[model samples]
Target: MPRNLPLFIAFRLLFNARYYYPIFAVIQLDYGLTLPQFAILNTIWAVSIVLLEVPSGALADRIGRKRMVVIAAVLMVAEMALLAFVPLGSNSIVFWAWVLNRILSGAAEAAASGADEALAYDSIPKEERETVWPRVLSRLMHLTSITFVFVMLVGAAVYDPELVNRVLDWLGSDLVLAKETVLRFPIYLTLLHAVAAVAVTLSMREPPLETECGGEASLWSGILAAGRWIVHTPAVCGLILGALVHDSVLRLFTVTASEYYRLIGIPVAWFGVIGAVFAGLGLLVPRLAEGLVRTGTPRNNFRIVSLISLVGLAGVSLAIPLWGVVVAMSFRFAFGLLNYFTSHYLNAAVDSRHRATVLSFRGLALNLGFGILTLFYGGLLRVLRDGNPVEGGNDPAYRESLFWMPAIFVVLWIGWWYHQHRRVHEARP
Candidate 1:
């Protein structure tokens, strides 16, 4: 029960619970950026994260984890400031500002990815970890879900000028805000959270390294060593592989959730409410995950998660109006469970020496898998579009894509499971 534990939870809440998340795409588009430009900016963000993920983790191992966490917090402040204060108009400058912002944001994400969790996990006494860590994780998840619901609701509400003006009127304010003026409101709120994260990170005490090998290794050597360790360690490798399968597909659906909602007869205005509901649902996940971890083996837990995903995806494919939202929402449970299980298992298996780097590898694999899936999805959409000009809209392609996702996940999961099983079988004495 060190101070780092609570600070770690607070830092995660502040660092990740960005108010702009609910209206991310809309804010960018409202800033005069076209959809194509928005897409390109996101691509840049993803590439930056992929490129920096492992290197940052390696550096965190060499340097202090607290140092990296502080750097990430500073970068977050800078990124949010770019959005908070960039002047309207001047398209070229604004676009470039966003580009720089994305790069900074990605770097921040990479720096914080493994270092924060590793730092916190290392703070606990070794003897108490197995019994205590699950409870800590469960508490963190519950708090995070509450924070997300608050952010989603407040963020979406403030993004609308009319909504803000109504509040102002009730408070006897004479000033009225315009759409452009209020568009940055969410960014401003996120900036405050970023600042709070910096304070929390600054206050954190870096626990003594559990392994002598942490600071002595070269960056390249550290990464290579971690890579080799993962390959040879069946449990760790299997955890990452299983996480990759679940994360990439679920994330793809999560990102395109708005379109899915529209197709399922949900109005655009209710999107924020739906998001809040989803976040609220996250409150139930940590308890269930804890119970599963206590009673079930990793194989059994993964099987349960796989079943939930398969059923949810199949139901989504049916595209039942309004009712399909429930099915779509079930993926949240699968996703939450997957995240908790992977974190618990991966951290438990990896050594403290290469902990951050291995976690970074997990992040890198998940991102790469998502990127590949996104490209495949794009190709699938194009093929669907070319095959039938009558249904020129994207809705048909989206439906077709939904229909195939579950099938694709099944094939991939089977292959992954078989490969892991073979590796285990061969390694046995």
Candidate 2:
């Protein structure tokens, strides 16, 4: 493996995801799909990932992380290619193509989920692993935020009709070709990002690991062992529960945030501006949370950060003005801390042989939470939107629907974490 394999992995992640995610909700709406329809699509993606997450993790541990990542990158390219070619709207063929694309995307997500982290952890020198791993995670977060800011600006610009028309005119495109180009440009751009990620993944090598990395056992046996470990391990189970609860609301917020901005009176074109601002603030989070990561127990960190996140979610759900929304969103700075500490804690608890498999258990829990929410929420959103149109930032039903339930979930999650924390400490010596 090259000395800079981590850098290459970072490069692939930096390019592979940012371009599409910032504009994802917008793309779905532009496709003439309602929120509920989009939620169903998300459910499909979650279901696909749920089915494959553990198996793929075990496969990565058995075969190699690099191979799994390469496979993921190829799947991503195929997914984007499907999206790029399919015309927008509720046409039967386009809808089915989008579904297929989401299924492939889910598979790609599962393949890469645990393998990247496991590979990165092993790649570090043993003597420096403790100190270096946090820094690597922090840098990765910072770089990812920076990439997000760049792509938000670029994606928003390209998706702007005026700019697209300007570019078409500069290229001397006929009116018909220009219209066609504008319609397809975003997907085409995303396809390029996917191809680049594949190239970058191909350039990297898997880090070496112990011979018994996935255990000298059958794949099913490996998975069973990992399941047993998760059930028996307090730290692992607690972390997974905490992550599922906290991330469920966060995931819902992410899916609807662009639309949330519109509901709060911010123009759609300015969504990128808000994203850039949030991403900039998000860059500072790992540094701000470093004290907790280095000095506090995982339970204590979760207690503190989960409280802060709960407050933010409440404000996001209740805030009435654009400035209020921006401030409320900024309150979510603790998100990165929650993410970092959970992964770090879980990694420390699990052994190397079953690390990927156990990590996939966490992914499974998350998808189950996400899928359930999407199904229940999708139907409700379908009803709310159909009855009341969103305009002039006064669609209380739609806006409330997005925030109220998630807020309730966060509150309940906070209580659950507090109980778990108390139980863990009480049981200690």
Candidate 3:
């Protein structure tokens, strides 16, 4: 019911709903960067987040969450500005400019990861949190879904010169936007959102921290304390572990969704529409997530997500013509459910002093898991390519990876479940 809660929701929407997300790769490539350079930039971005994620959370805990949020917003603006105005040629300067942009973007992501959630969650009255938090999350999910759908549609439309020129023609305007000009449109829109993020984050009221430490803790000390806490806290540890098991694989699938779509007979032109349809799932997914949270225990929820993930992975591996899209879409539900369950359980279990740090650990674990999976996938592709030189094994490698994902997930989930179960049993004395 506090002002910070709504502001937090608004800040998340603005910070995350980038218009260029639908055409992220295309925009980078259109800027004269090769695919290899693009991949390197992405790697830099990931490394930046991994390196800064936990430290930023500790800093947020040490300083103020609002300050970190504001920093993230500012960085968002700078990153987008780089893309919007950087030189077009494929020169070393342009590449370095993008590298700096990626670093700033990753830092922004790291700074915001746990700080924003901690700020908003702490703003709620303690007594009301049990009932109110779920509703807050559900509302956020719904709004984010709607925003992403709009961004996807409009972002993709504006990126295409033909689409923009046709609309201009219909309006009796002589302005014919070139691809170079239109390519920056999404970045410009995202810059506007970044500016809004700064405003919203600045307006947020910092909630009082309830420190468990004796006094102000150093960054290293805070990180160590949080790490130890997670090691000692079975519920929190289990929740994060379970989330990692599901989140990493689903995220990998999401990253490669376009490729999967192409292999399944979906045209490249319809990718934006498909993305919009995927985003639309947010409309109904939050409701289902909330219902499951209300009715199921953490164990039951984990099992449900696991089952959905397994089925979705197996079905997608079959690549059953166009209908496989349905199976692929199922991962969205797993993703939504896993995130909701993890957030709810982790927030309820962690203390305020280390809340953000613990959440950062969650982010860190998920990212590391994804990074490891990506490496394994890359290796799988390489092996497939080496084995068969005729077709380069691109499609087969992808399908083989997909086929293995379900089995891998199953093994990891069972291991995690058993480990948690054993820990619980041993602690019962």
Q: Top model by lDDT, which number?
A: 1
Clashing pairs in 1: none
lDDT of 1 by residue, 217-283 (tens): 5778889999999999898888899999988888777766766776787754566677788889999
lDDT of 2 by residue, 1-429 (tens): 335446544644544545545567777766666566688899999999999999998888888887887888788889988877776545676678878988998998899878767776777777777777777777777876777677777776676677767777888986534434554566777788778777777777676656554454667788888898787677677789888887776777777777777777787667777777777777888887777777887768877877777667766777576875664564447667777887777876777777777888898889878888878778777677776876654655667685665455756586766867776887799
Clashes of each: 0, 0, 0
Q: Best to worst by TM-score, what's the order?
A: 1, 3, 2
Residue 368, model 1, lDDT: 71
103, model 2: CA deviation in Å? 0.3
Off by over 4 Å in 1: 33-39, 87-95, 211-217, 379-400
TM-score of each: 0.90, 0.90, 0.90
Instruction: Tell me the tens digit of each residue's lDDT in model 3 across 119-235.
Output: 989998999999988989999999988988898888887887888899999999999888889889988999999999999998998888776333344778889989998989888
Candidate 2 structure, TM-score to reference: 0.90
Best first by lDDT, ranked: 1, 3, 2
lDDT of each: 0.85, 0.74, 0.83
